[model samples]
Target: MYYIGIDLGTSAVKLLLMDEKGTVHKVVSKEYPICFPHPGWSEQSPEDWYAQSIEGIRELTADCEKEMVAGIGCGGQMHGLVALDDQDRVIRPAILWNDGRTAKQTEDLNQRIGKETLSKYTANIAFAGFTAPKLLWMREEEPENFARIEKIMLPKDYLSYCLSGVHCTDYSDASGTLLLDVEHKCWSREMLEICGVSEKQLPKLYESYEVVGTLKPELARGLGLSADVKIVAGAGDNAAAAVGTGTVGDGKCNISLGTSGTIFISSRKFGVDAHNALHSFAHADGHYHLMGCMLSAAACNKWWMEEILKTEDYAGEQAGIHKLGENQVFYLPYLMGERSPHNDPDARACFIGMSMDTGREEMTQAVLEGVAFALRDSLEVAKSLGIHLERTKICGGGAKSALWKRIIANVMNLKVDVIASEEGPGLGGAILAAVGCGEFADVEEAAAKLVRVVDTVEPEPELAAKYEERYAKFRKLYPALKETF
Candidate 1:
């Protein structure tokens, strides 16, 4: 049988078709517009997501046997607020995960409500991008829309609901909402009240690999697919990517370098850092994990190359960068403010130590190195909790860079394992679909069989030491500029 994976991303929806053996048959992507009504705000239409996903799925299965598709799973952008009205219509454009308009709301939650109390309820402190803060923002700034909200959905869960006609979400995705009691795998009543939402307003929660419902008969028939195709409650993108890379077992790790960067550490036991710096969320494998998310990663490189440099030849621009850890320039990768560890929405990106001698190459190298350093900051927090890891599976757009991989490996002094597929959430969504259809016993079994490690980037002792010194300097820059931002 075949399985389908839907990756409902911030910019586009990517559909992937795979067989029971985990072989990818075809993949199709459809782009949509992102709206910025004001500075630091990001929004997208849920209608666009649903329409493009339907089109992408149709295109993805065009040459394949649509009847053979047994299951469908979604792995999508986390924490975007997708509100629906009494008639099941979108209340407004979704507040995206990258949106920083909720800084004031986040502050109130962390300070007035108290981090300890919030963490006790949800296993995480509020961030500007978290759904709870967005809820507060809506109540304060858009009272009319907030009053009309009958259902609150995460970005990917909205797609699931559209396809399956079931208002449901998986634990991994729900964890980012700051409405879930992650340790207990349920919605927190305290958080619900705080957000001024009732339990009925939330979607029913499920395990990521569990079947939510079958595809809607209308949707299935329209796409020439079986009506019985199972819709699995898929994961948030990071958790889904972890599943794709086989970062399921205890102590396993996966580092993603997409628009945002994350160091995801899978753990069988539930754990939270003292500062609530790392997110303690339920994993797709029915366990737990800690994740540190930075607002900018490959995005810094993209902005530098495309916007600042006015070129798309990323490879050519990177070719000039030879000195790994010896550059004098330093960059703070906080283009979209920061999350993990700092949790400061006021933070901004900057290049320091630039001199007359510094040219395009040196500045470019700093952007790459800066992202690695920020990831290391999160790794340091994980280490503080005694979750020691010597290696991590790497994925996402930035992982395609061999130079960046070497820099990441050396900067954090850990082996970077390159997986066979860089499909991340899309492949992970398919794997979950396979598991939900009983093609495998569970997520771990499916992951073990489907995911493959093709290469390893090892950190050299000498280079590692050089980055260690440079990282120390990068660490101090953020604190010194905190007031400036």
Candidate 2:
């Protein structure tokens, strides 16, 4: 039997085919446009997601035996608000996860409603990216559209509803919406009241690997698949990536350096910090995990290498950077305004400590080290809780760089393991599909059997000591510059 994983990303929909044995057969991707109506607003058409997803699935399964396709699962950009009216038509464009138009709404929720009460109810403080703040923004700015909402769903849930004719979301995805009682794995009544919504407006929740519904007969035939194919409720992008990297069970960690960077620590027991800096959310493995996210990760490198440097040769630019924690220049990786550890939306990217002798190499090395140091800020919080981890699995586009791997390992004083398959959410969705079809016992078992580490990068004690001093200085720069920002 076969399974299909659909990754509904912010910019594109990617589809991949896998057999029950965990071998990938084919993969396809389709791109779409993102609209920026205002300076800080981001939106996308739900219709574009559905159309591209259908096309990508058709291409992904073109050569396979359509009758053998057993299930379909999707992992997508979390916290995007997708609303439908009474007739089930989309009310407006979806507000994306990176959209920052809800600053006022977020401040109101975190201050007036209070962070202590929010952490008690949802295990999280309100961020501008979360779905509830987007709802509040809609209610205050576009009350007419808010009044027409019959159902509220996340990005992937919209695709699942279109494919299976069932409005559903998984616990791992719902955790980021600021609507779920994450510790109890249910929708919070207080959150519903606070958002001016009822429980009926939300989609039914399921475990990440649980089967929600079967594909609609017409839809299955159009995509050249079986009507009996199961539809599994997949997770948020980060959680799905964690599953793909085998970062499940207690005391395990994975650092994802995708568009956004996250330090993900999986745990059997639920926990939240007093300050609510790290997010306590449900994992795809039916457990709990804490994550600290930076708004921009590899994106900073891309912006620097491609736009400022006027070259696409990332490796060529990085090849010139040989200084190890000795450069005088320093950079702040706040291109998109940081999230974790520092919830400042106005924090802009800048360079400091440059001299006349500071060449391109020094600045380039600072860009990489800056990201690593920022990630360490979150690790420092984890250490404060006395939950110590010596190493973490690394994935995403930035993880492909051996130089960055060494930098992160030494800077964080942890061994970094590189996995054999770095497919992230697409592969994890396929694994969830396999589990939903009864091919595996559960998410943990499936992950243990399918994921493998191909190599490891060990931290150098001498370099770790050097980065320790550099990190001390790096942490201070942000605080001093906050007033100026």
lDDT of each: 0.93, 0.91
42-129: candidate 2 lDDT, tens digit per residue: 8999999999998898888888899999998888889999999998899999999888899999999999999999999999999988
Q: Give the winner by lDDT.
A: 1
**What TM-score does candidate 2 get on C-alpha atoms?**
0.97
Cα lDDT tens digits, model 1, 92-125, are 9999999999999999999999999999999999
After superposing candidate 2 on the true structure, give the runs of residues whose Cα lies further than 4 Å from its correct spot.
none
Query: Which pairs clash in model 2?
Result: none
Off by over 4 Å in 1: none
Write down the lDDT that model 1 would get.
0.93
